[model samples]
Each structure stands twice: as C-alpha cells, then as structure tokens.
Target: MKEKLYAIYFEPEDWLAFRESRRFNPGDTARTVFPSPFPFYGAIRTMLLKKYDVKLEYHQKPNLSQELLRKIGDESQPGIIKLYGPFVYSESEGKRKHYFPAPKNVYKCENSGYKTMHLFDTKIKLNCFKIGLAWIPEVEGIKEVTESYIELEELRKLQSGQSFVLCHAPNLIEEVKTGIALEESVKRTKEGMLYFLRIYRFKNGGFFMLTDSEETVKEISKIEGVFLGSKQRWCRVKVEQFGGNIFQRIDSKNVAMMLLTPAVYDGGIVPKEGKFDDAIVKAIAATKKTVVSGWDYTSGKPKPIYHAVSPGTVYYLDKFPKDDETVVKQSYYNEFGFGRFVYIPYENLKQCEGGEQNDEQSFLALC
Candidate 1:
C-alpha cells in the first residue's frame, strides 16, 4: 500500500536547544545550533505514542498491540513512518517561502555573483591520497557560500542550470546563559562547575518536515503540539498535503544528485563500490562530515554513532539510473528521512572561444 504524504510545519513556542554530540563539562561551552533529524524522529514517535495513551517504560519495551506495534514499532525496528526534512520556511508580506540547503559546488564571487565548480579528472596522485575525479573552481578568490539557504524558486533556477544568487534565511539569534552544576544530594551549586550554554531562537520562521504514514497522520491529527528538542520546547503542528516537486528530471546522461538530508552509508561517505545501482559516481563535493548519535529512550543508552555525509553534498554521476529510487532506498536510516536527494542536470564549464574547453589551464595548474 502506498503511504499518504503530509507536509508538517512546526512553529516553536520558545528558544530551541538542538545540541551536538560533544560532551559537556565544567567551563565548557555547550554548542546547540545543529539540528539533527533524530530528534524529530523521536519527537514524532513520542507524540504518536502519547496520543494513543501508550506508556513508555524505561529500560524495557512498552507493551503494544499487534496493530500499534506495526504502526510504531519497537526500539530495534521502525515500522511504517518515514520522514523527509527539517527544511526552513517563513511567511513574509503574506507570502510563505521555503528554503533548502545550498549546493556546496556553488560559490559566491567577490562581485556578488555566483559561479559553480567544474568537474576535472587528471592523473595527478598525492601520497596516501587517491585523487580520482574532483570538482574545482576555475578562477581563484571565489568564496564558498557559508550558512546559506536557497529559496525554493532560486533552487529551481539552479536545478535548471541557470545563474542564481544565494538566499540567506532570517537571522537566528543565539542566547547564552551561564550556570553552575548543582549537586544531586544537597541541591547546591557545585564550585568551579560553571558552564555557558548557547541556544538558538528563530527570528521569523520555524521548520517544515515531510512525513508519510497513514497511522502517523491519523494520530498526529488529534494533537496540536509536540515537544521538539531538549527542555521539552513546544511547537504547534500544522499538517497539509504536500504537492511540491523539487526533483527535476533531466534528459542529459550526466546528472547531479544533491542530498536534501544527511546520509549514512556502510562504506562511509560514498556508497559501496562507488555506484548507485549502476550509475557510476564520477565526482563528489561535500561539506564537513558529521557524526550522528542520540539517546535511546527505550534502552536508556546512547545510540550507535554513524558517520554521515552532510546535506547539500552533490554526487556527480555519469548517468541517471533507470530506477532512481534505488539510490536513497539503499541508505541507512531511510525511515528517519536520511539520504533524501534530488536529481538535477550536471552543468559543465562552458567552452572557450576557439573550441577549447574553459578552465583547462586551471585544471592543469592544480594538477
């Protein structure tokens, strides 16, 4: 049976603390800006369980009927729920705009213009590093687009191989609070245990998520709010039918696969054997890798750590597979919305005036 898709919006009621996996100690700062998808996975499941009056027992599995178990499965397995985003959205001047991660291959120039990197493959080899195919900028002094999110229309323009400026989302204000750890026995502040914690408050918009599950949609309809991240921060929920098609099909053989969410693979950043169902990966442009770990409510322990390829990473493929669904379906944590991606035409550097390939000299210089 096909799952029903729903676009869910989360409006936060207060500041949110989406902390990283670093350990906190005295005089240490707790960074809390990176929003991982695992929290939403837990929050949605918790909301569903709460809606159905299912009590969660610590260090033990909750008693569930066969029907409920099939909908929201045990700790070891996820049933039918699948998530797709934590994308950004805001309303301005009576218009709502969606935002997504900018592709890493795109760069902003000093003159406020945008330029994309070009794919190059050479016989250059470095010690202990096998340099196969790579994406390199033709000209020097181009800056990377940092902390940038592209508007939906701008993203569409990019997917269509057109020039587009990078769009910045509303400023996220960070609030820092200093506090001392308290002793458990006496409830007194522990000496020399002061720490500063930083949290983020959105200036205008919250987050948007894509979910598909008939049972989840039915249960979520009964609830008005759910706790999002740490401190039980409340967020009002709004559900509607999602009709947007962000992925575009290109007629060219060369295709660019851009990840909408972080993906985990058994063979690290690249898929096993460097192929996506026979579509050979030619090159890749990725941001800094991140480690994903979360607290398991069922077992009262931390979930196993998985190294993930960051969102906005672009994988250049020689051709689009006949079945593109096989790419994301083979990723780890697909039920939690990891490995979501979109296809776009691969744009190459334009040719020089005399029928020579542009950036040929730059590519050779880099080699």
Candidate 2:
C-alpha cells in the first residue's frame, strides 16, 4: 500500500531552545529561531517507541524480538519512516498557513520591491580556478533576502514565475535566563560559573513538518501533545492529511533548484563535479556553511559532524534533470529531507517584470 502524506504541527506550550552545535559556555547564548531536523527525528522516534510499549532498556540492549525490530528498527536506523521540514506555520480562523525560507536568488530592493538575480555566462578568474557563470542582481541597492520567509501563496507564485510580494514572518522573541553551576560532590556553587540560557517563544505561530510514515501517523494520531526540544517543552500535536504539492516542476532548459532545507554534500557546498543528475550547475547563490551535529541517545555519543549548505541556497542548472527520482537519489540524508528542493525556470527571472530593472549601460557600469 502507498504511504499517505500528513502535516504535523507543533504548538509550543513554553519557551523552547534550539541550540546550535557550538558548546554552550558561560556567557554564551543558546538560542535559535529555527532548528535542524535531528531533534524532531529523535523526538518522533522516541514517541513511537513509547506508543509501542518498548522499554528503555531495549534501546540500550537491542534485544527486541524480530517482529518488533522490523516494526521500529533498532538503534542507528529509523524503520520505514521519513521526515521533512520544521517549517513555520500559523493558524487563523480555523485555517492553517505554512511559510518557507525565501530563495537566495530573490532580493529585496531599498524601495520595498523584490527582484530576482540573473545568471550571466561569463568567465571570471578566482584565486585558484575560474568560474563560467555568475548570478548578478538586476538592479543596484538591493540586498539578498536571507533571513526572511514567505507564505505558501508567495512561494507558489515564485515557482510559477509570477510577481509576488513578500509577507512578514511571524515574530519570534528571545528570552534569557541566568544560572550558576554547582559542584556536584560538594553541593556548593562553583565560583565565577555564571551562564545565560537564551530561549525562544513565538509571538503567534509554531513549527510544522510533513511526513508519510504510517507508524508515525498511527502513533501521533492517538496523542494530543508531545514533548520537544530542550527541557522537554510540551507542544500540542495536530496531524492532518495534506493534499497539495509544494513543488511545481517547470519544463525549461534553464532551471533553478532552490533548497528548502540544509543540505550536506561530501564534496562541500557544491555537489561533486558541479552536477546534479543530468543537469550541470551553472551558477550558485548560497549562504554561509553551518555545522550540524547532535547527541545520539541510542549510542550515547555525539553524531558525526557535517558541514551543511544552508537552506534558501539556489543552484542554476543547464537543464532540468531527466527524472526527479535521479536528482533525489544523488542527495545525502534524503530520508531526513536534508536536500529537498524545488525546480523553477531560470530564464523567466531575467525578465525582471515584478520589479524595476536597470538599463544595460547602468548594469554594465555597476558590473
């Protein structure tokens, strides 16, 4: 039987901490508005085990019966389950709307309008090698929309090369609390050991994800709430069938792939050979790399460190891949939805119909 897609919403009951991989030290801030997929993976898996009446001892011992093991795989592997997102969502008037990271190729102008970057076929010499294609902004005085998000309707308009306005993301507030460390043996406060913990509380909305795992649907369907993030913060869980598609494939020779989640590639930010399936990468617009690592409860150790390409990164391709399956097959950690992307026509962006465009002379002067 084919698996069904479901939307899982997490409405937080209190402030939540989504810390990065960096060690939390005295005077350091442990806060983030967005979190990676690792935490959600662990949380859902644990909940599933609890629903099955699996004992904690079995997690460390791996002594489950063959049938039980098949249902929920032993440590180090998640059985037949796949996860995507931790995207932002809001509910109003009994309807829920989703938001997504804005594509890097899109820029916001000083005049409150948006513009798309155009790919130019020119060879430029770098420190060691030369690059053939580069993405150039259509107008001057525009900044890349990196730290912003767009509503689901805006994303659809973007995918279809239509003019769309940016929507303000839900507000997120950070609160810091102080604490002092104490010596465990002496039961006394450690001298000069003060720290501040920063946590986030959304002003209006919470995070959500899309999953097709039958086991997850079955277990979460029976529960009204679940604990997530640091301190086991409680969050109301809402699951519903999702019928719409987020990605719309465009048939074009020049296509752009926008990352919806951080991607980990063995060959660094760009894929090996600058190729994804049958399409060759012509240009790229990406943000700084981020380190992704987490604690492995099953093994009682830290997960392997990975340098991930940030979400919202856009890769211009020579053509659309022969098949979507082949493109996904080339990505790493795809089961966790790490390299998820949407393809759109690249040439349409060059028209600059949504926003003002500079003349050829001015653009050349800026270049």
Candidate 3:
C-alpha cells in the first residue's frame, strides 16, 4: 500500500448512535443471545480457509468498532440491502408484502434456527478494536481487486443455481452488475457489453444458466438464443436465496454441471430490450435451445403485455405477473418505465394475482 497524506474523514456522533435502535444486547435476553457467534464464525472461517483458502483481513479487534464508527459516521450506506437470516422471508403481512422494494434492510437469516451478530471487543488483552462487517468487500489474496473480478454471466448463473461464484468484482456490475453487490454509482448509459454479444447454453438441457451484458439487450434482435426484457434490456442483478444447502455462502452445483466461459468483446454498445417470457417460452419450446434471462414488466407496474413472438414459438415465463402489478417510473429502464413483476412464483404465491392457484398448483391443475 502506498501512502501520501491523502484524505481522512470522520463522523463522531453518528457512529455512537449507530447502534441506538438496532442494537441487540445478547447479555440481556435469552431469545436474542448469540453466545457462540465468535466460535461459530471461527469454525466457518476455518472451513473456508481449508476448502477455498478464503481469508478475511478484519480490522484489529480493539479499535475496529472505532474504525467502523468513523467510516460510517458520514458515508452514505448501500441502497436497499436485505440480510436474509432465514426467517425474515417466512413472516406474513405487515411491511412484509415482499417488502423488497421499500429499500429497507430486513433480516431473514434468523430462521433455520440460526442467528448471528457482529461483535467488536472494545478492549482486548493485547489490542483495542471496532469489529462488524465495516466493509466486507471481496479480496483476492491480500490484494483488493476492483469489481472487475468476476464475469457477470457466471454471477447470474450462480443465482440460478447453475454456476459457481468463482470470482466477481464491483466492475462486473458495470459491463456487468453484481449479483450481491453494486457500486456506489451504477453505469446506466448502457454500453455494448461483451457478455451480451454472444449466447451459449447446454443443448442436452441437464442444467445451465444464462447471463449477458446490456449491449446484448439492444442486440437481442440480432442474437438468436438471447431473450429481451419487456423493455428489452439485460438484467441488473437478481438474487435467489436458499433454504437448505450443506454449502457455505453461495451454494453452487459447479462440481456436478459443466461451466460456460464468456466471450470477450471490444467497442461500445447500444441498449436493446432483452427477452421477455414469450421469447423464453419460444426458446424452451424450440427444444435444444437454451435461454437465460429474467422477465421484465412481469412484476411491478404497467404489466408487460405479451403476445406471441409467433403463436407457434415456445418460450417460458421465468417470472410471471404477481397479484399486485404496479407500474413504477424507474429511470433504470430507458425512461419507458416498467412493471414490477414477480420472478419467484413460489415466494409470491400469496400475492399472486387471480389467487386461483400458485404456479405449481396451476401447472398441476393443467396436468
């Protein structure tokens, strides 16, 4: 690390107040106690080190809390981060109607009978610290790679349970938006991204996930396997959480399935509408053709109205419309606006429109 007197900023009071309302006193309550958090973390950390050689360089124990306080004192936080502890996703009603869009941090990891809280030892036998995930950015070796680390497609496939989370960086979010992370500023001009220029999938259909760059969105009209979103745009990042996995962090089946490498591209790109459900259905119906994408306008407002690309063509609706189809004027879309559709039918079953049956039930009824 090189150093010249650069810049150092501090936030005094806000740091002290950070834990005000959200603070959990493990000592005070039996229900909220996380007695073995440190040990469990150590066990997990050890396991990761043994299996993947992943090491975390945390701030020194005694002063870590102080460091966290100073850094968070003034800096703005990430947009709409939800912590899925496991239970938060199960509760019904009251601020939980898929409280995803509200941009609030809802913890759902409490379920699975698992609970964890960050700890900062104020004074250590040999050190002083402030410890909590102050800045949990991924690190390769001791060097901090920018978001350019992972390819966007691989990350998205990881979301679909097909690929492994081998490597990812904040930059992947630009030419590629990250699955679990986003930079402070998102690049929206929609440059022709390399991931969008080409398409690939398993012909036999054992398992594979699709990913692309924004350039692919505009170019889908030209690309064969690619599907366009309602507005015909490539996806930002969409996450799918898990309930049971013997694996830690991102659960991947990389060991079982084959991998797809991304093609490299040069130059700029214009935006196109990525594929919609009709397109996906058509692709699936085609047989031997694999499509990877999320449904646009399926959720949200201004429900994306679909007609067949051609009646005979088959496509799949990855995310069908939710019960509450609301149109939101999101600048994310090319000013055309979009509908907030539901991607995971099972999760949104209660809120599915028609209430007649869930996707599975509907499919079953058909059968």
Q: Ten residues in a row with the worst lDDT in model 2? A: 24-33
Q: Residue 256: error of model 3 in Å?
A: 26
Cα lDDT tens digits, model 1, 38-75, are: 77767777878888899877677678899987886655
- Model 3 earns a TM-score of 0.16
The ten-residue window of minimal lDDT in model 3 covers 11-20
lDDT of 3 by residue, 1-367 (tens): 1111111011111101000011123542211100111111122222223333333343321222343323211112211111111000111232111101110001113222111111111221211211111111111223222221223333334335442222322111112111222233885422211112121111111111111223212222222221122222221112222222211123321111111111011110000222231221111111111111221121221212111111111112223212221211111221111111212100112224674554444433543
lDDT by residue for model 2 over 200-296, one digit each (tens)?
A: 6875568888876777677667667767764678888889887667655865666789887777775576667667887877778776665566545
Number of backbone-clashing residue pairs for each candidate, in the order shown: 0, 0, 66
Candidate 3 at 307: error in angstroms?
36
The lDDT of model 1 is 0.69
- Alpha carbon lDDT at 150, candidate 1: 79
Error of 1 at 150 (Å): 1.5
Number of the top-ranking candidate, with lDDT as the measure: 1
